[model samples]
Target: MQKAYKRLMAATIVSFSFGLNHQVSAQSDTYQVVSTSYQKPITTFETYIGNKKIETVRYAFGNAQYINDGVMYGSETDRVVDLKNSKQTVKRLAPAPGQIRKYKDAYYVMSLEDMDHSSLTKYTLDFKKVGKTKKFTGYGRHLILIDNKAYVLADHMKGYNYSIKLHTFDTKSFATLHHETITSMLFAYHMRQVGSQLKIYGIRPEHEEKLTVLSYDVKKQRNVKTMTTNQYVKGGVEKTQTLTKETELIFNQDRMYEINHKTKQVRVLYDSKDDLVDYAYDAKTKTYHVLEEITKTAEFRVKTLNSHFKPIAEYRLKKSDSVSPFRVL
Candidate 1:
């Protein structure tokens, strides 16, 4: 290919055996600021899914917990501040640093210091007080979340060496999810259900640089590399790469890929530090709110993206500004 000059936007050709790498729509939608705050060793935000904080709740963890607690990708202490205005009083577990998420007349908490010294956890309200929550010893480095039924993402962990295994169960009388292993380190994860699907997105990459904005698809138990193309010459020469008709580093190493259940097209989105990746949508208000990384800060700028993935309402949330990325209802 000659004259390959794709500056930034994600443009692709056809669907590959792996999957389609989508770009943020160029048109601006709508995104209204539900709320904003800044208070942590790292810059992170949270927003409710509803109008009032009581009706909805948003909680984000600090960066320091990533390494110490191993919550997400950082070891920051498990410090959760209820940015909600609801009557639900979040009771702290103890000096261990944990909060019981409460919202919409429901409640739950990420208890257990360590479940087999493995497993990954999120920060969502734990509703069902299910059956015996067994802390499977030697689990994996993945967070486990059970919806109405008993479906767990058996999080495997080995000092940050993570591997994932999926499991399911029938909703019976009671369930108890727990961790069996406990070290001097702190651990806390959240979970819940939203809409028709269970959406899971993590900003932490395998050591940051390892899993850059890239998509790795598994088809038929094979590590299928879709969206990747190969070149063949009359001389029987062949070369393979994840480039379109034109080759460019359009996709970052830390990109997040989501397959549209409707379009069946694999769309890529990311919450990272690369200049090419950004996201903003008003599932709450502004119809659509966009975020761009500042040149010299950890804050994501606020903006509105059009239907074509273009910016509309623009506002910069400096490193000092703590704005939640997206709301989970």
Candidate 2:
């Protein structure tokens, strides 16, 4: 009887230990995702963990444009929200912030002072002001950090003629490296860095039949190639997400295409009936988290896809009139 009792106690102890370890493993695998509404005045930020809604934070000052390391950067308000604790911190250092990039212990922000002027400002991780660049005479649209260099894409107007320019800055010292005009005809919207090439996509002014893609070599510091495609001619490419070092995923309305930069080939990954809002890829689990909007039902669907873009699991969010389309961060 004593031996049997000891054996039962040992089995219970092992079972408890196994269950505890499993819980911890599951928690470690869980990742956080942030989504924001497209409405005005009050910007709502929704935080999710594996298709489950965890927290909703609303900022009345401005829209949150970027998120990094559990902190959300607003457009007009420098607000930071701790995802784990749901605490909000406001810092009014960079006003009218457009794009934010973090390098080492500093944060670089593009501050749009007015319609014609934009400045690149640096701040500490805790939102303390460090320094700022001289205001560029253009409207800064995109900011990208590649290696130790920071690239800013801005639009400049010389009388009625408008030109798109690319400005490069040293990340370590914030020194101006290069300021080059990319195009005088195309209204550039988005850019992606694949390998050593910076691919800029834009639409020709007054001409909407084709989308122009300009490839710029970073090492050579010159325009290398230009191509036009009819794939996303009407509205242009909405979003570009890097899938690998050599390939990226571009979204056009409800369709998603995988483009190989080396071969210059584009392949459709998924043509969904619903509108694809946003998507994110997890390299650790080889999974894709995609968010889609059901137009008929007016609901949002969170989908988990395998490495091959096959749907593995899906969850439908409750319909809400207050929130607009969501973008997975």
Candidate 3:
């Protein structure tokens, strides 16, 4: 009995010593900061994972922003910083990173280049490699991801003229869905989800009169090429509402119109004239918010509209030179 008790005590001491040694080595690895004259200026930023410091990273530039959950993502040179596990995981992404966006359960980093071709790499939340989509010709700086699809707009050389190329892909499986060439519009600037549809607004090829909006129904899998004519086109919507859905409300510089897509009927919703400073739409509230600048009295006014394009209420704000009193929802 005495010999058995001594063996048990000796085994416990060995296990405790091994654990202590492992903890000391991990601490030394995590807390070590390398300093050198060749290194750039280091900035210390705090990242918290449930009230605990997961990791610290030294970078030349880039501010970390929350992507989703408690994970924070930022870019520095050719690497991506994942702040977690009480240590910073620096993963090599690309040489020239363009933009980083989170979609579904993965993160995509676009790589920009001087040549006509570019690449996009996909990674897991912990910076694990998923896959890459490459060989995109003249891929621009804009990317739009809706649902499980990613739309990439690129400028391709079409004989003597340049045409905008739209490429659609399934984000989950990374498969090509559609590729269409738009000859009417020069480039697209903004894209959004409008009433279960994807809409792209951009400047026209002429670049003269006004911006144009192209409505695409990706759900139907109709990736047809839409060519614009002077009168009316099936897929194009003018700056004004030539045709719209019953629930679709259109807003331009100072006027708002409700449009009928099939009948090509446009009805006036609201007209604020030149007083319209900015406008926004809230998907949750299903309302249109507008800000109007009263130039004569140097005052600002705000108003909200319901789904029927009727004004609910208006409020005037006090004037202050230090701050512009216009707010867009």
By lDDT, who's the top model here?
2
Over the full model, what C-alpha lDDT does candidate 2 score relative to the true structure? 0.71
Q: Model 2, 1-329: lDDT tens per residue?
A: 99999999999999999788645533433333344554554456566654566787665533566665545666656554433443455556666778777777877788787777888887787778785565677899888888788888888877887889999988767788998897633788788777898889887654453466788898898999876554444446768887787777777666777766667576778767887877777778777778888889878877777778877667667666555645565
The segments of candidate 2 whose C-alpha lies over 4 angstroms from its true place after superposition are 1-62, 78-88, 146-148, 170-175, 204-209, 243-246, 321-325
Q: lDDT value for candidate 3?
A: 0.55
Model 3: what TM-score? Answer: 0.47
Give the TM-score ranking, best first.
2, 3, 1
> Model 3, 71-121: lDDT tens per residue?
333333566655454565556666565566777787776666644665677
lDDT of 3 at 11: 100
> For candidate 1, lDDT tens digit of each residue in 1-329?
23354422223333332142112221222233333233543333333222212232333444322211212222224344443425323323222322233323333233335644422232234223433433333433333223443334345566766554433323343243322222111221222233333322222222321111112121122212212122111111111112232321122223333333223244443234544233333443324344445546555555444433344344553243444332111
Per-residue lDDT of 278 in model 3: 56
Query: lDDT score of model 1?
Result: 0.32
